[model samples]
Target: MRSPFVQLLTARRFAPLFVTQFLGAFNDNLLKASLGIFVTYRLAEQSGLGASSLVMLAGGLFITPFFLFSGASGTLADRTDKATIARWVKLAEIGIMGLGAWGLWQQSIPLLLAALFGLGTHSTVFGPIKYALLPQHLGADELVAGNALIEAGTFLAILLGTILGGSVVLFDRGALVVGGVGVGCAIAGWITSRQIPPAPASVGPDAPRPRLLRDSLDVVQYVTSQSKLLLPALAVSWFWLFGATVVSGLPVLAKDVLFANEQVVTLMLALFAIGVGVGSILAERLLHGEVSARHVPLGGCVMAFCAVDLYLGSLGRPRATELAGAATFLREPGSWRILADLVGLAAGGGLFTVPLYAILQHESEPSHRARVIAANNIINALAMTVAAVVAAALLARGMTMGELLGLCGVATIPVIVITAWIVRRGLMKGVVRLVLRVLYRVEVDGLEHVRAALPHAVIAAN
Candidate 1:
């Protein structure tokens, strides 16, 4: 039998969506990475900002849109056909790329930063539609497999984009070439999106139109009214926070902690990405074609353990002022341990996330599912923002890179434990039950009521 990824890639319903999502992800990273490198190497004198600060600023700008727009995006996804929303978003990407190209041509920092924000806005709008589309298109049994493919494809896209962006920036006129590539990816994504069949709108045409500002403000209330759904969404957000923290620490770890250069940084990133991709596919196989929460605790523990090990491996390395190449770094003792730890951490992360996504989709009511995803996105953006702040504060306060990483690793344990506690108390079921009892005033005695109402109910709180 063909692997799940291959099977999904060949299937009509999934293939087009897959390609579109992948290309979008690819271009997002490509733009960010390319702009980062260009600013760091080529415009350092002109920009008057150090390479590290410029890159950090770019990262912040890219993620800021998600925080600002995901709520409205969720409303849009729920109010219209997801495929239609995707098409429009993809179309917008063409113009966004044009802006980015202009930025590159002019070598303007402000324009480039605006492009980054624009790309992030594109992603925010697409986020709700992408996840919501899967349930409408795929069978319940295929949910895990579908999410696995998207996650794997996304990571692979990031890896390729990062490498391509960094590599292209080395050549003369690289910015123009990068801009050209961005336009191409955007065009390709738009073409693929054209092929996607119309997906169900969460609300009926006769239903009262959702007010974006009002609905966005109500997301927190919606989440709270369905208490069980809250944990899974928070867990998803936490995963982002965890991943961002690790990533934020990497450059420092590669340079100061490990005495390795940029190539080693690339290698370490590649390992993490590959590991997540491999782990996602592996989780699908290990579950015997089912979406189960049983593996989540195991995965969370594994991630925490491996991250700690990574910190330990980074410690007490031989003192050398000179930067080591990839090969030289690999030859040194403990390097393998660090690599293995990173791979293991990423794999564990994959295992941890797939089920949480499935849980979010499966638990949410159809009409509110996209909105729930938007809430998750908002939380994710906030968590990541907080993580960045925390990492920066810790680093500035005389903490070593390895020690900061180890702190984050240690922090994961408590987070996982609290999530597990919430899950065990049957909070997800309780969320549904509470809605039935309070809103519909129906007597709900058990988890059965919650599960029965999950598919069709439009959850709201007075």
Candidate 2:
């Protein structure tokens, strides 16, 4: 008797959480996009660091915190009321933005990098709470829709932030503009954070907390012990690894290999981001708010295929003399192929990621949910770092971007194959069936009991 959209919206727990999460993502991306642009133009020019070095430094600053703090962050989420944590995290974001504003005023590369690290730390701390709290707030039936909306909102934020950052950087007072916007976004995010209803702690407040190192090790041990959780987490980590490698290499590829300009690179990024956003939203419908773990295998295959095709497409790179403006880049015969590949890769990425995330959220124990997510963030950060190193190595070795991408695609194949094998194992199937049966019982209690009892009685009579 309820409209579908209304039903989704009227769900008490989800509504506030969705708004809170969306704003958080929006703010994060807004700040990150502005910072990325600021680094690209102002920092590199003023600090005497080459553009590449500046970019890499910025990336490193943002990623390092995840490696260092995600585990601790996860534990905190498990130990606290998530709504309280979300509020404090938002407040922390405001302080981080203030530091960013200071960096902008001084144009101090070190300060900016430090602020970036602080921001990353804040994000890392929030990671586990963000994901872990969802299952607490929403029923299993709502998870897919909730996650899809989150993914869509996050991507939309990224797109908006990137566009805003790009526009602001062209201004004479770009730094001031970016700083003001970041501060404003942080404030808005904080305000939204207040609306999130309290989520009860999963563990006892008086439970003895482990030391940091041991706590992190425990998170890893716990997650790895559950195959349903472990496989998806590993698969998600690999997606980030593959993506980081490609995206980090894209600038170099665009300039050195594709012989294209900055605008082209930006456009390609936009295309990929948009594709991912669209694909993520579509996953909601495809998954129907249930366990659609098979999407991971399917997405992995598509990703490998598209990556290989992109590599092949790049084999006949146009000469430097053939370089063109953004308009011409779009109109060129070969450009369409590249664009298609980018879109496909982006779509595949969305398909690959959303399900894994849903599975992680769905399978994790509520108390340790945040810690599990923190582990995911840690792995993602590590994978990205490795990707950067590998990309640099490939570049140093004089491998063309296309060739490097091809190699990455080839590398992904083995990972995907292994994931598929794991997913197909009897143990995994048994676990999945058990989870599904439990969920089904929860959904249709009397009917499930009747079916089970009737089947048992029939077997006894036989």
Candidate 3:
């Protein structure tokens, strides 16, 4: 069989879709990161709110739309041709970026908040379309590779965006520069979307587009009806939730616990993102184009273990001066341990997430795929909201970032245990049986092929 990477490249439909998805992710993060930095540094001076509070507010403004609009967006994706939806979504991004540009020019916090909300809305509307479009464009066998590439692209984009955002804020006219870059990225994403092949609507012409609440209920009902789909979808949602907690808490952890500056914080984030990207792409290679649904439980186990390790890594606070350059940070005894923990956490996150996404796409019905993705987005937003509230509360209660990390680590154990139990109950026997059957079949094929190559050889069908 051809290699997974080769197979992925050979597929006519995948390259354009990959580019479209990657650029979309890149632009989304570029804008979000730039806006986040602006709120944290520039807007705080005008609004009189502390940087942390403003950052939290910016996060809320960005995520709230997912909760409010994902259902509608999902339904829209199902009802329309995905290519058309993608085009429209990219157009919407351009308009949203325009608002962001205006906000940046005015240096208005209110305007920025409004622009953020608009961006959030744009993302919410695109969520279902993005996920649902994949099944239409790719074969079942390509799902894993597709998801891996998408994940890799996403994390890499995040790394670049975070770097750019932080770097821009140090410049004299940072907002304008960042805003211009964000606009350009959005436009580039739109150009990529235009190259995507036409994907016909999976939903019927007569498919009922219900009211928002009704549509959400129907989508939930539809998703839950398929056990394989529901479980993985929930797992994917949880992954995002966990990710949100870690990412949102990083600045606090770096500054308060490690006594680090922004550069150090950025380094930690970049390392984590790079680790995740590596792991995600590696999964595709390891799986070799096969459905590796069985890996999900293993990934969960690793995630739980690494989360606890991260807590342990955070136990002892570093000395104030230790948090300097990357070289110095790496040379420190404790820093190596922390870096190891971060890598473990990121790798486990990739393993846990990439498979779940592949599973969700593989198992969900095409007709309702977008709605299911919308549901996933809704849950992700809810999880992020909860994480924000909880993190804020913990911080307010005089808990250090290290202690909060410990609590999250402790909490992850039960979560992983429960999820593993559920997955095992559903998938274990079937997977074991399939493995045994494949082994037996492989041996039989080997013997038959050997006989077939010999002179006057007889082949056995059995």
Candidate that would win on lDDT: 1
Q: What is the TM-score of each candidate against the true structure?
A: 0.89, 0.86, 0.88
Q: lDDT tens string, model 2, 1-462?
A: 653335756766666666666655655665666667777777788777787788677877788777777777788787788889889988988888888877877777777778778878777777787678778877776677767667766666666676676667547888787778887878877887787778878899796564566777677788888887778888888888887777656777788777788788878878877777666766776666665675566677777888888888877776767656688777766778888888888788888788789989988877778888987787777777888787788778888888887787788788777767766664376567668778775332344355447545543222
- Each prediction's Cα RMSD? 8.1, 5.2, 4.9
Error (Å) of candidate 3 at residue 62 is: 1.2
Pairs that collide, model 3: none
| lDDT winner between candidates 1 and 2 | 1
What candidate 2 gets wrong by more than 4 Å, as runs, is 1-12, 29-33, 36-40, 44-51, 425-462
Order the candidates by TM-score, highest first. 1, 3, 2
The list of candidate 3 runs beyond 4 A from truth reads 6-12, 48-50, 321-323, 422-462
List lDDT for all candidates, in order. 0.83, 0.75, 0.74
Backbone clashes in model 1, listed as residue pairs: 228-427, 228-428
> Candidate 1 regions off by >4 Å?
1-3, 48-53, 206-213, 422-462
For residues 378-455, could you state the per-residue lDDT of candidate 1 as single tens digits?
Answer: 878888999888888888998988888788789889877886675564546556767988999987345445556778
